[model samples]
Target: MTDFQTAARAATVAMRDVFPATPLLRNAHLSDRFDADIWLKREDLSPVRSYKLRGAFNAMRKRPEVPLYVCASAGNHAQGVAFMCRHFGVNGVIFMPVTTPQQKIQKTRMFGGDAVEIRLTGDYFDDTLRAAQTYCAETKGYFLSPFDDEDVIEGQASVAVEIEEQLGRLPDHIIIPVGGGGLSAGAISYFGNGTQYSFVEPLGGACLRAALKAGRPVKLDKVNTFADGAAVGQIGARTFARLRDVGLANALTIPEDRLCTTMLDMLNVEGIVLEPAGALAVDALKDLGQSIRGRTVVCVTSGGNFDFERLPEVKERAQRFSGVKKYFILRLPQRPGALKDFLGLLGPEDDIARFEYLKKSARNFGSVLIGIETTDAANFATFFAKLDTNGFTYQDITDDEVLAQFLI
Candidate 1:
């Protein structure tokens, strides 16, 4: 066995001391839908509800001589490290971006208890990482990198180890979620050339794809924080070094909105509550299409740290992506029977979700903001056709992010 495989196997065995291996369950719903023997590696079921715990435990255990551990994360990694710190009875100072969800922050505290002190700084993970490293330097604490450390990579490879053991055979394909690249790098190291791998990243923060295209890791100009767990401006250099040989062929980027639909589907249909990042692998299954049919495929659902507060946002995005919900701004004539005429355009399935009218006294027309949700996506086409046929003037603002921030 290669050195990495050897270390990863050892990590897998050591992880039993902390928590049992997360389940590798046959997802009948996905299997039937895709015509494949689909399995979900339930990393979301881990003690921290993320595969990050494996890496954090392995990395911290190796440095027992050190009295303290430090790290930065958006959420999952922080929880992982905090859980490990409590497990090992070691002092941990976790640095997290201020934007991290309250659910995660509270959980990390609950896990670490009094053993860990959390400092919230930075607007992104990279900035949080820098602050952590600086604190580590001054305090002489062992800084646990979320993904960049070699030991963490080996630890994360335990996921691959459990998969092979649980399945009793190699899967034809493994679809993995990519954020900082630690888990993907570790899996690649453990599996070698025996299996096909698909790396799925949030479209707004596809650092792995960007790195493959540039032949080096580069910071993205901007990152959408919707998929908070998997959204990072840059991929880890150490993780990228391991992932370099894979190229971009197997990498898939799922749009943030499109991914929301998958999240809602998994929740409503399968009763699986997957966070935005955790659903990355499942969302890629749609794009895999014919390639995975009749074959055994594994999707690593990375984390289930979804806060209930985000449910409305998730539903909104899912509706928009499905084309069944729309927002529009229209110029309605300020005349008798005008409002009634506009109401006549609605089909039986159409429901008005929002209607706000702003009147301009100097003008003959009033600006009206409307949100419509219909039973079928095709209903929008018919609705638009009627609007065009009539004299009503409107602008579709569902996709207009600028106006959405201000009006919708």
Candidate 2:
């Protein structure tokens, strides 16, 4: 075993004093869907509902003399550090973005109790991270990075150690979610050449993939924060150093909207709760297709910190991705029977989910915003063809992100 792997195994053993190993359970639904023996490393069931606690615990445990610990995270990392603060009975300050979810903020507080102080700083994480670092430097407190530190990587590697012990042997493939690369790096160090690995990232925040392309860590010009847990704008330098050798072929990026569809499917069909980042590994299975068929694959379900309030948006995105929902701008003639004639063309499966009349741009033509839902994708094709044959002028706005953002 490599020296890193040795440290990872030791971290796994040390973690037994904190929490039991997360389960690696075979998932029948995924196995049936992919024609593979699919298993889920249920990191979502960890103490802080994330694998982050492992890194937090390991990093803190190694430095008992560092009485004051500081960190910057508005989501899982903050909660992880807070939980560790309470666990180690140490003084810590957690910096969080002001726009962080109330649920996360409350949970961090609950976990830390009086052991940690919560600092709500800038609206963006980058701004908050800088603030935390400056404060730590000035106060002589140790800054605990979310992924860049060696100790954290050692801690995250515990995931791989547990998998090897529980599964008896390495699986053919392991799918892991990538944010800053700590978990992926740790796993790679632990498993080495024993297992094939696939790194899953949100398309909007594919920092690791971008870094691989650049041959070094590079910041993204813009980041979509929909998958906030995994939406890191830049790959951490130290973490990327460990992951720089990862082949671009092993990285997969899933669209944020498409990830929402997977989240909904897992929820409704499998009764599984997955946040956007948590669903990354499972969602990438579709892209792998036949390559992994009949093989044993383990997908790490990284976190389940999804707020129930986002369910409506999740359902909307899922329906949209499935083609069961659509939005269009219909050019309606300003004449009698026009509305009735349009309604008569509807198929049996089609239902008007939304209808609105915008102010007319012309005296003879009135613009109408319409949203339709159908039982099948084929139904929309037939509906569109019928509209074409009848000389209906309409623009499909379902895919117009900019316009949809403003109007939908």
Q: Best candidate per TM-score, number? A: 1
Q: What lDDT does the true structure give each of the candidates?
A: 0.93, 0.93
Off by over 4 Å in 1: 359-362
Minimal lDDT window, size 10, model 2: 357-366
Mind giving the per-residue lDDT tens digits that candidate 2 earns over 1-408? 688888888889999998999999999999998999999999999988899999999999999999999999989999999999999999999999999889999999999999999999998989999999999999999999999989999999999999989899999999999999889988988898888889999999999999999998999999998898899999899888878887999999999889998898889898889889999999999999999998999999999999999998888888898889999999999999999999989999999999998866678989999999999988999999989999999999998999899889
> How big is the positional error of residue 24 in model 1, measured in Å on the Cα after superposition?
0.4
**Over 4 Å off in model 2, which ranges?**
360-362
lDDT of 2: 0.93
* Candidate 1 local lDDT, 1-408, one digit each (tens): 898888898989988987999999999999999999999999999988999999998998888898999888768888999999999999999998898778888999999999999999998777888899999999999999889899999999999999999999789999999998999999999999999999999999999999999999999999998998899889999999999889788999999999999999999999999999999999999999999999999999999999989999999999999999999998998889989999999999999999998556726899999999998999999999999899889999999999999987
For all candidates, what are the clash counts?
Answer: 0, 0
The alpha-carbon lDDT assigned to residue 115 of candidate 1 equals 93
> What local lDDT score does residue 252 receive in model 2, on the 0 to 100 scale?
95
